[model samples]
Target: MALFPPKNPVPTPTPVPMPAVTKPSTLPPEDINRAKQLGTCIRARFAQTLVGQDNLRESLITTLVAGGHILIESVPGLAKTTAAQTLATSVSGSFKRVQCTPDLMPSDLVGTQVFDFATQKFSTQIGPIHANFVLLDEINRSNAKTQSAMLEAMAEGATTIGGQCIALPKPFMVIATQNPIEEEGTFNLPEAQMDRFMMKAVMTYPTAQEEQRMLTMLTHLGSDTFDSRTLTGDVVSISDVEFLRAAARRVHVSDAIMKYAVDITATSRGAGTKPVQGLSTLVRLGASPRASIALTRIGQANALMQGRDYVIPEDVKAFTHEVLRHRILLTFEALADGVTSDQVVDSIVQAVPVP
Candidate 1:
């Protein structure tokens, strides 16, 4: 009794379980080194399969690394479809070509519900949009309804059928091709849908020498060419491709650069330039927040593709147009005056100070 008990017993607090600390990948030394090696191999392989268009090819590669969609506008027979197919082959991804026409329907691109007489219930028949790489050939040729069908998958990466949303395959990308020369039967993509694409690239005709070389290559290769050689026999597994994209989310971007991207985009809206040019004056709409995001990722991807561990201003500059062009919308007045979106973007880039 004299000894009694300890003055008072204290209650101990339960330990809070912290998230598993992930060790930062020091594998940059190894991973990036291998990525660069694969990139080199890809470049060499593409050079053989395709001629010229170095800029476009690099942009396409950057798009893949950036995990974004691309819209290619060009005349027919310029290998637009071939370029998309070759790209898919290089990545060893499933490819599907959608011949968009006026008669094309939403179900045509995203599948539809079918009545299974035996089962006495409706079943979902998936469409070509389920693949890893989809070539929306002549997208502009499709009617507004048909074009709208792609909006969901392009933006959400999934299609809803029979009240259930089906996720697209990993590394999914839609490389849409539109013929800008022919507007007679073509339906221009509404501004809303255009912005869904990360970049709108124009595929121009090859030069005389390049064309002649392409012709020679075609004539000389008599059934010797396989569909397309696999770049690494599996350099990037589907899962690995998903992982690489997840890693991109961790790509560091300083606030300074983020502001730079915003400023450049905001300036396109109403911020004035030398003559006080405002996109509102000429543009019906300005680039959205998604545009900024695309720029950041694409910029980081551009840096990574060049074997750099970090992103820089040059990367942003290189990707600015592609990221912003399609997102910016010019008014009818601007169109009547022949003021193109490219010109507007150029002005904004010049006006916005580089960081």
Candidate 2:
């Protein structure tokens, strides 16, 4: 008998007709121009502070425009924290950074009721979670109990304290960073919490040329700390970010593109009527409906950034890895074989027919 029994083959069902692609709404030329300008300014500021990792920069901007949260994973010294902070500083919004640790408590994140002896009353003191842009640095270092405290805020844009629900500041977004190289004193984020993030950006070491440029830039700056305030001319207000987000929402998405995004996520599950070959053996779980929704929204954001008013297949393909990398759960065999989620996503993307 085989170590893992692989017996049944799923017979393909008769194909159902896909819905007709409806015309999508288009953004005004002025709005499109504004989006392009904002994107360019943000990227330019990022370039001044960071050497490379263009993809990571784009992912951060895309997530911001899509009104979604992002999770960044990288080894130490990759500038993950710097990238997030730079993006936060680019916008004129309240920013807070939480250095997560095993001792962090739920009350330390959300607010807590404090007794006001002088006033003879209790007051609700807000925590760092109330900021417009919140960065949870080294999130995995915190215990699961402390991590659970973020679920409500991240999912509903509100946090509960002492039976009172308080809304987070407008244009709220969470940028979480985790170190993949460290496993000791770390807790694995639950799947439910992980799904809350719209995208997971994996950062890698920069190329030789990029590293050399970084050295020269830092040496010229005369210090290791890079001040984002130097790009004051490029800073955008909260209203500007809201405008770009509205533009992204208006960017048209055809039914064909919608289906294409859904198909890519579905094929990963091995639960679809027509499953990809060997997918079931490798994947223990697949992405949720949220993944499909994220793909569409991020695609719209990407389209707007590229000076287009409508999403295209290329828009959907551009960020497929970032969108689905964290959602898929691999089996033991796949891990033993050293297969990665990116490889799995590539296979699924290839298997699904492009619209």
Candidate 3:
């Protein structure tokens, strides 16, 4: 006892408690109505600004309501990035845009551990991926490593760093863009990257009348004064998205429609003798099982947007092109015959007998 008492005893410190993990809250019925109203408002606002790009506007709203990601391929100066940010801001969702370059790093996306000089400890510094809505602008311009880093966040909905796993904010969606006109020095997305998207939307130029309207608007407001976002009055809150997403969950999908969805995806496999004569010859790689799931989810969202209690075959058909366009890889023969993936998808739809 005397020998032990001579030495000072060390005291143990209390452990710091970790925060409790909780699931994201659900949206109430009232919030769902508000979300639908907000979707209409944003769609109208974007349509006026984007000019004759109704298809693109529909794609944006559909993808957002569906809680899915979209990849847009278009020429430059079409407001692709601007539209993405405006959509995010219009919905009160935090927007982050990453202008991809060849040298961007993974830390530039999922964040990194930074050493605090004063605290003498490493602190976590989150990157752009933390936002509710993220746009990887010119995604193909970035190298493969950067692309993979982005895909990780999209696929897993979380990122691991420094022996810790962090979940992204709920209702997270990624809208990446690619410039099709530019072939030089652009890193094409691999098959894996394409599979992650729910749709591939192509933005075409405005029609003659729409272009005239745009020019008139430009002349009247002037480039310096015209602000497209000004039209998006009464922005939708993120909570509204939560409610609408909940509503989409309640939308009924019948067994007949379920079989129809499966058949569409199955035809994409290019296996077995089907009504479409050259179906297997056209595709080098067909849609996967994920496409089937996406088709159904997107169908439900479409029905909900239309104020319907159940999904119809038309809902599946409406989104099939967008769902399968990016997923199909046309064979050399298909390309040689000028048979676009869109055409092949149409052929498959025609071949498959509707239940």
Candidate 4:
């Protein structure tokens, strides 16, 4: 299936462009340069381990800088797990991979109170969710109950263990992967849980050149398994991640830009005083306020990566599909007509006025 509809399916509306703002970014020049260096370092490290999927790499970095969780959907053998693992290992922190299954219990992800016979006392044993980077491979393979257990950690960065709330490590992020091809024995993620993610990235197959490079790399290694830890010398420290996030937060966001984001989200929902045309019928539900916030923050991250202190319309437009795809729910008619969330988002972007 096509990820998006044909170009210009919806009549292109003349964008009512707003006057450009002359304000500069709040971040200092040194900080902006540092952010760019960090972003480059991460991409370079990812290139050493993973073959291609530039969009996936950028999405991961943007989400990391924005301090948000991500949901990755793709078929098997697309290196979804490899990408997540490479991102985790590129940073100097604890990394954990949870292979989700139907029988996986909540305690398997969080933690449980264990009774120790040797000490005649109960001790708290934390689970894999406490790590800095957590890769939940095949997340949908687990039952809803087990999936919901991650809510607390993802939202609040803390989990309640035996009536005690334990804070997770800082610089924490969840990169969840789910196979779209296999639906049997897999439970769908709840809407509430879905909304918790800042962005949902969809990975696609690589090009012929990229695949050939993969084959060459595999032949050079003489094995199928690729160890991402080979680039330990170039690992980005936790402090660097914190600094990059701080810099991203400092990236300037104007009121007009904020309004543009809200407008795009509102148009998708077909809500407010003036909803954009041609979207109400296709959308069962629009993106939430969180999506608006995500759109703005992701723009900030993108701007920082580009060595700019201020966000532009292009930054927000660059990630609109990723930010709003999983958030919007489609109607029966839209689905029957083979409409995707990407198409809906594309139409909204074209219809909304740019600031």
Candidate 5:
């Protein structure tokens, strides 16, 4: 890693504001019969209700099927929160939402021990993280201490409280949102924690047509309360999603694609000759091996979503931006030079040869 890499130092511009639930999880069927159908239904429902954010819908669905945490960076009113809740409803899973505040505590998320008055025994009280789907809204607004509590569940499916680690629910997934363009009263996520996320998705503005559709949907739903709970119609049985996840683990990737994925990670490293022509100077650090692994798993999920049993390079490239964008740290020099991680990823994908 370089002691210094040219990167963006621009003061994060204060940007637009964003506008933004829990239920018992029915055990999904044990069979993997409807996983593919579930994935398609989730996407379709989002398209209908979300009105826009096509890119977010695609990347988020990929991460969900892959079973990984995602960090979404966008201004408010972009439906990041709504999307998380809606996805949870699509699967009929238990959902929990935590509003990240500066005063939030670790125990508030991971849980603590409470003394039972009758027995004088300290029983464990689980926190919001025990649910199958969790939405950590405005994650950066919380202090590091509060943020630390999420690391375990997000990374290991367990959280430590009262000196004990409690396992979270099966198929746990967290969709954490941060305001990347704001600096007020927000704590930067520790690098170690950042690596735990499978992807950092940037939500872009909706198209004019999409925005118009959103308005129309809002008009149609007037007084109807288009809440996330409404997403629970028969999409796929819970069992089907479970089976699909198991199937995704078996999705085939050729060795050539594997090597190509590794090469991309290695080339992103700032230590050696830069793999992408102009990036060496801009990046202080390259994508981690975890990034490589995530890329592969996400590729499999992509293939699975597309009803393919095997992965292709295009599938790998499909998620490169979201999977590696935050993993690659840009140098102050790169920022000064107006270089973006998206550009670096593009350069690497274009320059890397397919096998």
Candidate 6:
């Protein structure tokens, strides 16, 4: 023991708990089984009825299980309305079809007040918006006021009558169709109104084989009532849809991915650098923060549809076209130069790197 003030003891270093790096959950076997079964059921039904449209079928399943609205854009007779109506029938939910026109009114879609002679008071009458599933055919044919009425219901999940609010049914989702060819009699969907839709899908012409199949089916079903065909009620339900929504909210999105979304949107607006995709030059408006949130939510649902418990870069990439295309607005110059919303979305997806 050579003294040096007894060699002052170094205080034991207190161990600080390192922040936990949470691991993303792997796909649960049970969820995978259920999702696959649901996918199979949807395919079996859609395959017999619709020819070609692999993309449409997949997107429809994703949208349905994800609890989001869909917008189908196409020329008339492209099966846009038929596809929507088929899905509504398969879901076994209350389905209402509203043929949008210039004369359509707000009260027409969301109901109005009626006088009750017996009770000597006004009673609230519900509208087609109260259904679990809606087919808004040729939505662009409506005037601005009528469009606004539909938009308000889609955004708020409720309708107002006589200053009173009535909540819509559970699992409420709209499948709207627009004829892109006729612009003269139609009102363009407002940018804000377009953003309310979770997905914007274009319905293109089917292949030769698909067309043959469609023609054959139509010929066989002639003079028969199509209304008799019904879907199984137990396979899916409004309550089940609510549960899927809850599960979607729980899907984990990494911070790296979040930053990627922010950077992409920022780049579009020329926030700190030269614009990408000629976005600053062509776009009068960029997507709002709501677009980011919608993307993440739909991405999660897309993942779950694929039997994954966590979202991957692929999920985000697959859905960007549908989620962002309608949100971005192009200037007149951009339209003249053949720049469309889909082109801008494609540019953003290419510019943003995945984690």
Task: Note the clash tally of each candidate.
Answer: 0, 0, 0, 0, 18, 0
- The weakest ten consecutive residues by lDDT in model 4 span 225-234
lDDT per residue for candidate 3 within 89-126, as digits (tens), equals: 66777778899989999889889998999999999988
CA displacement after TM-score superposition, residue 82 of candidate 1 (Å):
0.9
Clashing pairs in 1: none
Error in Å for residue 159 of model 3:
1.6
Expressed as tens digits, the lDDT of each residue in 1-355 for candidate 6 is 5565576789999999999988666556776667666667666777656778877777777787777898988877787877787777766568999999899999999999999999999999999889999999999998899888898899999888999989999889999999884566877888778988888888788889888888887787673234426433334555656766766766777887676666666655655233474467888888888767767777788877777787787887787777777778889999899888888877777777677
Q: What C-alpha lDDT do the candidate models reach, one value each?
A: 0.78, 0.91, 0.81, 0.89, 0.80, 0.78
**TM-score for candidate 4:** 0.91
Worst 10 contiguous positions by lDDT, candidate 1: 229-238
**For residues 111-224, could you state the per-residue lDDT of candidate 5 as single tens digits?**
899999999999999998899889999999988888777886787788887888788888888989988745578778888889989989898888898888888888877733
TM-score of each predicted structure versus truth: 0.86, 0.92, 0.87, 0.91, 0.87, 0.86
Clashes counted in candidate 4 amount to 0
Q: What C-alpha lDDT, on a 0 to 100 scale, does residue 149 get in candidate 4?
A: 89
Q: Flag regions of model 4 displaced more than 4 Å.
A: 1-25, 272-274
Taking every candidate in turn, the Cα RMSD to the unseen true structure, in Å, is 8.7, 8.7, 12.3, 12.3, 14.0, 8.5
Model number with the top TM-score: 2
Deviation of model 5 at 127, angstroms: 0.3
Model 2 Cα lDDT, one tens digit per residue, 85-183? 999999989999999998999999997999999999989999999999999999999888788889889998999999999999989999999988445
* Candidate 5 to truth, TM: 0.87
Model 2, residue pairs in steric clash: none
**Model 6 C-alpha RMSD to native:** 8.5
